[model samples]
Target chain A: MVAASSTKSISVTLRVWRQSGPKELGQFKDYSAKDLNPNMSFLEMLDVVNDELTARGEEPIAFAHDCREGICGTCSLTINGKPHGPGKGIATCQTYMRSFHDGDIIVVEPFRAAAFPLIKDLVVDRTSFDKIMQAGGFITARAGSAPEANGLPVPKGDADRAMDAAQCIGCGACVAACKNASAMLFVSAKVGHLGLLPQGQAERDRRVLAMVNTMDEEGFGNCTNQYECSAACPKTISHDFIARLNRDYLSASLRSAFRPEAASTGGGGA
Target chain B: MNLVGSFFRSSIGRKILMAVTGVILIGFVIGHLVGNLQIFSHPDHINGYAQFLHQLGPLLWVARIGLIVAVVVHIWAATVLTLENKAARGSNYGFKHTIQATLASRAMRWTGYIVLAFLIYHLAHFTLGAAQSATFKDNLKSYVLTADYRVAGFPVVNAGTKVADVYSMVILGFQSPIVAVFYIIAVGLLSLHLLHGIDSLFQTLGLRSNKWSGCLRKVAIVFCLAYFVGNLAIPGAVLAGKLSPQSAKISAPAQR
Candidate 1:
């Protein structure tokens, strides 16, 4: 419990998933991580293992990461059977050695989903998210340059909700955490973020429809409302956005069916 | 896109179908429970209720067919969704640990299958009289309608008319301890199913929000518990001899 005790080094055995290629057979490979600082990040522990592996002329583990601070959404390890390791609202890079005991055996694997193909050891293709974003996670309005701060008076409540939803980093933890591998939480975050704003209202219906269509086409499964996605989310996104999505999709589908073809185009600026 | 076409094509749309169908099935469960509770009343009262239902004739068939459709659709949507969810997970994880999933949420498909089996057996035993002829169709009995037999005090026919004794049929049907135990187990599973399914239905339909989520789960627990006890009371009363072909006015919750 003292600061001096926190400085004590720890050792652990890691059972990491290792695959040579996307099509290769992968299995768990055990490595001993010894003399590690309890404050060392999980990725840093992997770096130590890689260093030892390179010295022994063994292939180094291939893991994906960028920002060690957890903002880039680039860290995608499923440590100890959970995305982003043992903590809440933090990415894998943010997971520290102190969370695990000294003699613990940590198992790490990459996120798994039909839509996200595994590329190498501890890295999977997350381009499916990009495709979903391309579908309708944007607006067509050209409000060039910053308008007067008061010109587009968005309600405080709507502005706050939009900001909350916009915090989503699109790391695919929602899918990884879900029993169904559902991307509803991720898709809902994007849809809810934009659909809550004035500029976003111009294509609100189209945005939800197109994003959902793309999400399904990518082969992600349907949500059963178990909310594992929210529990697993690194950004701590709420599943409430999913309810907002269902409402949007329902109204959109109904409106699209009833709207005349000529006026189907949603005029800009609500 | 065409409404019907899009409704079935999209995953969210299919979930909407599931939620809507779930609503119909839950309504039927509540209605069936209420109607069956009348068995505790005077023999003439329950016999009169059954007679009034039989008199419905074509209308009864319509309601029955509608309920069958709801059941079929609910099961079908669940099957499709389960398969799709399994496929989406792609490969099983080597190290598995559930963080926050409830027992009712995890056991949904299993409880659902058992409940489905219970439904089939129930219909065979009581509705069609196919499961046990001695306890059902061959057990001959009748109740003579008195002035009190008038449904809601509305006179329909002669007061002395005799009607088939459904009261005894139910009494004899649950006489076997095996049947009683099976009813208890099945109804218990059904209560568990509703505990999760009803709350999930609200979320799927966009009816559950952060403000209502906690209260919603508590409400579901209370309702499921009461429904389970209501169902448990019937067979419990029968097995304890509180109700028989010749007796009535049993202890209410004590038998349960």
Candidate 2:
């Protein structure tokens, strides 16, 4: 966290939601802060506010953080109804104050999705995402005994497709942006990544079917071709991955109907 | 086990429910259109069809009960899944680009709810005989005379008894331009709902394959268009006066 510099001066009002715990009701508390640098990152601006609160013998706001860099994806905030602020392809940490003009009244609130329960202040529990991933995300590769790097020669197209799906960081941004709260994009990315890989062939069919089943069991909405999730993803995961996921699922369903054994073993490989 | 929770919460569960319910709904629509086409036939044919349905009595109740269960499960699952999805997101995204999504896809939930409401209103107004008149009251003499006035092997009027004033009700209801417009809008909304719902059902159930997804999408488009066209015909014919008010008086006893 960077300290506030006295060289530059600006004033802004922040309406932030404050809650002690999940069970406790939360309300927005207003704070007036001044002398903020335009180049400072959004989180740094928050640091200034926290510093002032601590100096005044007030309890500083508790928010999630780890890598101040965007890669960690822990920072979740809805600044003026926009996830991670107004910047495109950037997390809250990467969002600089320069994106805002002077006298901008920002409404900073925690993510409001039901799956992500608020922990404290702006932090939320995104464990539902972890559960969805754990259900069928990994290939059946055993560790310790290293296989040959070229043991499986994957086609360039398949490799590219897998990488595209792998880019998703489980940021929950897709869920936030979706009106139906459909996590098809997130689940589809995971399903598509493994389904396209030769190494994942051992459980490809079962994986997609099981993962999608688990996703729905978790009470996620059915994806209705809303591309909001993809657009909102900080990683910019494509909706095409979802289309691929749909393809895999449909084939798996048909195969299961007639050839259950083959579907269980996973069919076709590069 | 938590049947409702499982149906809504799991992706496969949602897909299964969506597919099963969607297919059932489509079946109902097709069957309904087939029965409705009797209007173009001799009035006795449509009246006889309605009477046959009415004669089912207890069987009709059973089917209605089954349909109600399916509908409840479907709607409940959809709502639960939607709520859970909303909960998963940490926050809302700002500055959504219009180029990335189709209006039909974006407004799926809204359209679905609107269509559901419209369906209920339609059933209440037409089928249940709860909206206008409680009974069929067509002039039998007029119907017989009209039926006798056959042109090109088609009965113009085949009024039987003064059972129910369904014909006048339909004509009167549709005569109000607002009501006709509402029906037209409702059909459009239903099409939008079907377009999104069908493709989504396949995705949810893990039945989508790359080789066949395109084909499935095309099927969905055709199905939606057909549904829209089939439903639009009734109101269209009514507005055009091709379906006379006297002809509309044909009604069978309301089952249940």
Candidate 3:
């Protein structure tokens, strides 16, 4: 972590949620962060405060973070009712102290969603996403010699759409931001990315069925088109993919209904 | 599981139903507006149209039943999806701000319920003659009768039983300021409902793309506004005294 330069130091107060475990009731605890550098990243400010708490023999605030440049998506925080802070198209770690005023009381809490049970202060278990991914977020290409880069002549439109869907980092900001705690955006991203690719076409029907079933089994809420998920997404993934997912799921199910063997045979890809 | 059963059980499936039913209902709205727009013509134009509909016999009943089924399914699916969404939220935010949602999008459920209530009231007032509000009953009573009204081509005008005089019934119905105001409010809400619904239906059906989204949204807005203006014109004209059948010469032989 970079040290705060003395020239442009600032002061602020953070109202952070503190919880020891998943079963414990979390409450807001105020911490005064003095001499914070406006140029420092949001997480660095927290780090400085945590150092002070440790020196005072207090329990340091715990928050999840990795690859602090915003790609890891491990840093999940709800700042003032917004997922990933106030910055658009960026993760919580990308938020800078300059966005705040001196003495501003910043309220920081973990992502709030039924599917994302709180693990500690500003940390929640997002493994439900992992479980859904494990169900069917892959193609069944064998681990062999690499294929030629341009072996598949995929249409540019499909390729671009696939890439757009591929941008999801499974951060759960979408679930956090949604009113219904729905995972449609996340699920759609996964479903769409695979379904759009040529290699993924073989098992597309089975992939959608398994992934959607897993999503429901994970106890996530239904999507009602409030669209807060896409709005809150750090990656700015479009909600248009959700519609694609819906269309695919419907057609896949109908196809299965008419040809059960197609679904049964395609399950091998999982 | 059966495809239909599984479809209803899934969230996206339910949305598909909402989109499909919404499209069906929109078709009904356009058909209804066109049918009602005939009221702008001479009394014979509208009354003859009503007579022609009545002459459809069993086919009219089938169409009516189909419309009722479409409406019921649309409402039922929308209600279930909304309730499920509410239950999913679990907890409300302490401080919330909507970034991308519009007023029409946010007010979809509220407007939908209002439109549903208006539908019931409209049917009772116009279809079943059960709306006992003084203005509606008075309008029905004072309606200028057409000669030799028949049900299925048989004249059955018993005492206290009135002939079907749709032209005057509609004209006098809107003569009530309260009724006119209610109709305006309902249609306004309907436009709001449609504004979001039309765009969302395209989205739900996966027909929306970056290239077409803006164009489709503009189309939806234009359609909703036009429908609102066209439907509202009936009551507006009635209140403005432009559609008064009594003022028009009834001597002009009622066109068949």
Candidate 4:
């Protein structure tokens, strides 16, 4: 997509949420981005507004961001009730100011969910996800010479599915968009990425059980099959992974129930 | 911890419970519809069928108890999950936009409540005889046996009996336009609920696949619609005076 000349810059108003800290009572503060370049990304427009606020002896807005490109998934904001703005399959940083009309009031707020406590302004502490990851998001592989990739001979279909689940960026967009604040999509993606691979077979059962248990402990809600998470996901992760997660968890529970020894055995060779 | 306690506490486990119980209830629904469709047959046929069921005695009660348990479990799980989901989203979005949910899926809770209410009212009107309309119970109480009934020229020994004659009750119960309309509306909602629910149940039970998801959804929709139309035709036929109390007896003459 080509951007127009900077001379065609348009002015817009932003109702941005402001908060000093996690416990602070946040409120939307109005700011103007006058003569902003139409080609400027959403973050650039925010930068312009923050610069103006600083110049005017006012504290600039605090928001989380990195890798102005879309990949990092660090830029989290609910623009006009949409995660990563109105565009499909694009993150916040990838959203151009041209998507908005001149003089439009764009409401920018943090991803609102109990699990994601606000740090300041649009930045929420997503460490809860990190906690979930710490629970069982790893596979134990012995330290040795790297094995031949083709030796495993993973089915192409399984690999493709695993790759689809591997695309998750931990953005918390799913939680933000979900009416239930469900972490099912995120957890399933993480579980599927490893569970679908032969290397992850050592602790596949334990991984799903541990991660799902941790997810509940973190106070995230359940998946009600609303499909909002998949729809709002910038990575385009399919909700089918959640069903797969449930299947894995169910079978794991049953196996653990009937054959306790099998579930407790140490990591076996592939 | 006991396996049962842990199962109910987890979200996915609870969903699985809901799905399993839902399948049981749906099975009952199809059975009930098939039995009720027998109303189109001779009065003796439906009345004899009801008598046969009553003869099962303890077995019939066992099935009833099982259905009650399934219904209770399904409703309990749904309520618990819905409340948890509500609390999860403590703060509402100032401007909400739904990207993928359908009207039926979005209004699941409402339809669930409606279906529950209809179920209770239905029990009173038919099963319990508590809220039997004027036409149903009164007409059944005053029903006069005109002749000895026989099916296929074979003697039905217990025919022309009046012990809990469900045939007359159904025909007379639907005579009132209000009662018929309510049943129609309730069945309509039942269809809507099933449209989203059947597919969702398969997904919850981990029976979903990329190759079969679309096909499963289509099957759910078609089945729900067929169920709705089949049930609707009953009350509709009654309201249209096509399946009245007399039609059952009038359709076929008494055979010795």
Candidate 5:
């Protein structure tokens, strides 16, 4: 096969949101990106932009990304108002320039949330997510010799549900795309994962109760059932996790109310 | 500051705070509803409830302070978080309507602020004794015992003594066309806030998932409606004269 020495590149204008700090006024700065390879990952394209900014003695844009392989869930960018640059099941780093035609105007911005504060440019501190998870998620299983994987025969339905919830990467993309910045999909995923597994059964009541209670304590707006989060989720995690969470929360609350002694005993089992 | 930071910034911290504070607020609402329901139970019951709160001595003071702190933190965290979210978005969209957008989602922030304003007004009118109209002061005087014990510009009295004319104030305030209108608007905004706020809390704390979001939404809607109706009942009863203002006194002996 003959090797090609040179390949044609496409040029596009990028309107990127720029902010000095969380408190500073922010605006979009437009730059014409030239000679970009279609195969370049979205972050790589941004690297080019940073290089140009550096060459021009300007501050480089700030954005968040870790483990570009789509696992860490740290890369958060909303392209043209869609999280992860309009791609389904792909992180921002996995998004390639091939998705856009030449001369297109790409609007790049950070995921928005009150709980998520912008450090600079497209980078935001999403530690609020960690706080939410910390509210209540752990089971009382003590570390011990590895038991057989099949030691616990979880119902097929519970296993499937648990697997579904185990998929969330804590990306905060769902929160970013949501109109109210609701984190239901994210919360539901955690609740569902633990709520289904037999190991999670012990703490199931407390988990749901604590999680839902903590969710309200945070300043995030309530979900209005718009389902924007599920639609916008890159993994396409279904909204069913939220239903399971609700059921768990209700049962936990009811059990605590009508059967406090039984609920306490159940808590001890976990 | 770090405590505040952890409280507002972290998901678990926020969830804890939200749950604890939410439970407190919910408890307050339930208690308030129970006390208000006394208007239906008997005029003396409602007045007795007000007198009981007034008689709390140091306990009343503690409860008031606690409530103030809770309200402040709740409002502060909400405002800060909302502002941060707006900043994160960088620029506001210029009115692109989408099919899936709900009125609750669209007005989430605005409705929250409206509710905040309403809460302040509500506190001022009821708790802080801010005069809404000429009749409110007269009505309050009839029920609430206003002694020389003025703490922080608010009238205070012993718990046993009937403080300001609470029942008449309720009636008179609701009777006023302006005040009645404001209450309606305030409760409406509260309903909207609850509708979205409850669902959002679950999501923020990572308790929601794809499967249960629909059910949660329905529950949120139902609860919001219930709260709205519950709050609206007192004013509705007042306006209809089912609960007469003149007959409503905190220390009034049994009519039977």
Candidate 6:
């Protein structure tokens, strides 16, 4: 292990959250990360620390990561206070040692929220997000084969806006950044992504209603329209999706409440 | 959930409640501010206005009850939602931080509560006349109308009528430095509250979109600043001696 800070290498101290398991008492433990290449990713630096820790016969710090690239939403670390570290449109794995000065003390913790309880050091169970997604069912579409490009013509405005919402990686950075731990941004993104497409129209009403209901049921807070989630999003998802979700939910519930056919057929049973 | 159940139970429902009642309260604030601006006009205009409102009697009570209902619902919705929001957070973060939230947005609950306090004090000071010293309250001036008061070029009332003096009450109320300072501070907080409140109102109601969000933010900023300045002008003018408290006191009728 590179144990010393060389002339060309930078070293820093990591204040890491050490929780052995779910429901375990956790505490921030300081560990000096020595001889780190400045260009190494934050996750790679953690790997180096773990290697050294294992050699010393100490239980290595546990963290979560996958695809080390920015695409996968698996890496969930709140570097310092801001989620995914002090950067915009990048996840924890994408954060590099070069971003910090030498000898900087970096604080690391899991993406903390009631809906996302920590399971181990720097890893939280994000299954609540999966539940929210399940609540919003599959949109009606051809399943067997790839359809023609122009099979369903979509408006340019809607297609573009839908793509914008579709970029959300479900990273929970929005929830981590939110003061109230609101999942409005995350749920709204899925709702907007599916709700905007031509195929999405069939289930749009039920989709928005169910997803938002599940989101609240999972102990997620309501949107305060602060836009902090957007700022923290690795994909920079817009809070406008939350507004769309609000509009869609209200319209859907109202339409269901005042269904003309159901009301008119109420006496037909006689 | 059923429509009524959704309105009372869900987060989105509560948000819509806040927005709808927000619309009503915003209307009241705008109308109250604009009408009070007539304090700079001839005392007859304001006193006549006051007498006209007083003449509404039952209608005025209807409006009051309506405003009271709006305030109650607005507060109730906010309280319930805020508590849920707090509960949702569960454990606090070890490290505190914020990225894009505005100071006003973060302090919304505090500002709303303080504004509620300010509203009660304001009603007591001006509406009930309970805030002022006993003699000061009794000696407030009146206006004996010299000409018929017209609305849209039609006479609403005949000439030679007496009306309660609103102008003197306002001027005297603002003449005290402590009251004036408090008024300015409270209005400032109210404007800060409005900065986020107006923007959030549009967002919560689904009226806002990316296309309009930018323009809406600019409009909110300008409106909040303008509202603060409008509120400032009254107490400021009185404190500056642009209007005379002594002259108002001299014109007051003899206490019965």
What's candidate 1's DockQ score?
A: 0.77
| Model 3: CA > 4 A from native | A1-8, A56-58, A260-270, B133-163, B245-256
lDDT of 2 by residue, A1-270 (tens): 223233355678888888899899788898986768877888999999999999999978887767978888788787776667776777888877777766778888876676677889888888888888888899766766767979888899999988988888787777666665677889888988888888788888778777877766565565656577777777778777776776676666656555533545775453
For model 4, residues B1-256, the per-residue Cα lDDT tens digits are 2357547988888999998999999999999898888888766666666666777789999999999999999999999988888887766776687878777888889889889999999998887778865544444653333344444675443635665566778878888888889899999998999888887888888878777999998898899989999999999988887776754555654521
- Candidate DockQ scores, in order: 0.77, 0.24, 0.51, 0.63, 0.09, 0.72
Docking class of 4: medium
Q: Clashes in model 4: which pairs?
A: none
Q: Of the candidates numbered 2 and 3, which has the greater TM-score value?
A: 3
Kindly state the fnat score of candidate 2: 0.46
Query: Which one wins by lDDT: 3 or 4?
Result: 4
Q: After superposition, how far is residue B64 of candidate 1 from its true place, in Å?
A: 0.8
Alpha-carbon lDDT of model 6: 0.85
Residue by residue across A22-134, what tens digits does model 5's lDDT show? 89988888989998998788899999989999999999999887788888898888887788876776788888887777899998887777667788988988777787788
A126-210 in candidate 6: lDDT tens per residue?
Answer: 9999999999846756678778979899999899989998888889999988888899999989999888888889889889888
Per-residue accuracy of model 2 over B181-210 as CA lDDT, tens digit each: 788898889888878777776665546656
Task: Candidate 4: list runs displaced more than 4 Å.
Answer: A1-8, A143-145, A262-270, B133-139, B142-162, B247-256
Instruction: Find the 10 residues in a row with the least total lDDT in model 3 chain B.
Output: B155-164
In terms of TM-score, how similar is model 6 to the real structure?
A: 0.93
* CAPRI docking class of candidate 1: medium
Better of 3 and 6 by DockQ: 6
Give residue B246's error in model 5 in angstroms: 1.1
Candidate 5: how large is its RMSD?
Answer: 11.3
Residue-level lDDT of model 6, residues B1-256, one tens digit each, is 8898888888898899999999898889888888888777666667677777778899999999999999999999998888888887776777788887999999999999889988998988888767884424346645676677676787665577877667777888888999899899999999999899999999998889878888999999999998999999999998997765435445763410
Q: Candidate 2 — what's its lDDT?
A: 0.71
Top-scoring candidate (DockQ): 1
**B71-110 in candidate 5: lDDT tens per residue?**
7777666665555445434445322224356777678668
